[model samples]
Target: MVNLFSHNISNSNAINNIYNIIYDYASLISGVLSIIGCSLNLFLLYILIRDKQFHTVSYKLIRISVISDILSSFTIGTGCLLISYEFTYDGGIILCRVVIFFTFTSNGVSILNLCLIAIDRYFAIVKPFYRRYHRRRKQIFYLSQIFVWTIS
Candidate 1:
């Protein structure tokens, strides 16, 4: 692998090789994750959209989570793909920053979306009094999508 290549090179070359290797690994992982995430998201979306009875607060949150996951997957995956395809980053400084920013923001949004789902479930199960609070979960789900976009 690149590690073996690095060991045969001089110090500076080794450093550069290490960077390339890390970048390739990141891209590979991101691509794989995105493929899986997108597949599952599509499936979940199909199920939700097809079943009228499944349109509940819980399903609303699930849809939101899947959307977030899909976005996260694509942003991260595309950045990684670009890095792997153009090892020297042909996109230049602005794109590099943009890609990195999106990667981080999507990851953060995905995590926060999951956190929100957990909170919603907790309220649904443990705080029965507040279950009614989530009667507007679908609207809040849309609002959360907007919020995530604004923050990101």
Candidate 2:
């Protein structure tokens, strides 16, 4: 019969090798995508700044989403790269927690901002009058933006 302890050790070594391969490839891919995402976000920000017409509530939400997407892309690459180094190293677990928290939190914020944009579009369409007095609801819009960032 095969020795159980030796079998377990061999299996664990195989798993560790697989993890290293996956982590290295994942980090490489994530780094490339992060660079692309950050560049796109910067371009969008430039347009948001230069264009006067795209400063409405929905567009503002989209801007926020783009910003958070940039943050998320950065954090995702960071987390992947960190994991590419064995996570058991000194202080690695805490670093991972911090990196992963920001990654997920920014992603959550981006998604929530998209949802807010959808809601704004719905109101603009279903309640056509809602578009007429955006200035009156400006404070509410800002508050909702704050709430979205906060909750996420």
Candidate 3:
């Protein structure tokens, strides 16, 4: 859709599209991506919640990651929707701080989730003996997740 509204009007590759509504390309793209991302995450969350096969410690972490993704998507989507609708909401300092905090926290949680998964995979692959000897209980992973959330 953004491509359809060519910035370079004189360019040969531009398509002559006719429309009454003018859209902000950035907002539209962000909103579209947010919807798509939220949908995919919701689907994956559903599968994880419903399927017995996905009920494992590792999958629990994945589920948490998916949740964070959903949260971040919603945050972005909310802003985009407001902008697209031309809402004159210039939220002051407190609102801005809260929004920024949540965004960064969710993003940090996701990165930490990946880091946990990577470390687990690395241990399993590189030092099987070490991992076998230091086999942690499910409580450890659960605690780690809690820690990750709190720290994030």
Candidate 4:
């Protein structure tokens, strides 16, 4: 009975080892992809900010979205990769809370920015009159972004 029990334990350990190996590989692949994606986002953001001609309301919204995407990629994507590698949050509750907060906030900002962009486009194409008013009140766009960040 003891020998049988030992054999079963060894099999379980082997299975767990295999699982860990697979998880590590997956985490590595995901981490690399996330880094690449964030790099592209940063490049786009740099181009947008550097080009004075693209300094319009729509581009501003796009910039915000890209910033949030980069944030999300760094925060949430890193968190997931760490988790896959069985990294413990030895830093205590505060660190976990901060990570969670930033991940959620960044995702929220990205979604809100997309919604704002869609609304702006709708106004521009569907109601030209409203679009003119929107252009005149550029402060509204800025305020909306502020509101989104605050809420997030």
For every model shown, what is its TM-score relative to the native structure? 0.62, 0.77, 0.71, 0.83
User: Which pairs of residues clash in candidate 2, taking residues 3 or more apart in a chain or in different chains?
Assistant: none
Q: Write candidate 3's Cα lDDT for 1-152 as tens digits.
A: 67766756645333433221345667788888998999999999999999999986668889999999899888777666656664435553444566567789999999999888777667667876884425674666878899999999
Cα deviation of 121 in candidate 2 (Å)?
A: 1.4
128 Cα displacement, candidate 4 (Å)? 1.9
TM-score for candidate 2: 0.77
Candidate 1's residue-wise lDDT over 1-152, tens digit each?
A: 99977767778787899998997888788778777777888888899878999786666667766676776667666766666776554565665787677667766777667766787788878986764566776677678767866776
Cα-based lDDT for every prediction: 0.73, 0.79, 0.77, 0.82
Candidate 4 ranges with C-alpha deviation above 4 Å: 80-86, 89-99
* Candidate 2 lDDT, 1-152, residue by residue in tens: 46998999999999999987887888878877777787888898889878999898888888888888878777766666666665676677687778778887888888888888877778778886765646556777788888987898
List, residue by residue over 36-151, the lDDT tens digit for candidate 4: 88899999999999999879888899999899889877775676566565555674355567668987898899889989888888878888787566666587797898999999
Residue 143 accuracy (lDDT) in model 2: 88
lDDT: worst 10-residue window of model 3: 12-21
In candidate 2 the C-alpha lDDT for residue 84 amounts to 61
Who is ahead in TM-score, 2 or 3? 2
lDDT score for candidate 3 against the true structure: 0.77
For candidate 1, the per-residue lDDT at 145 reads: 67
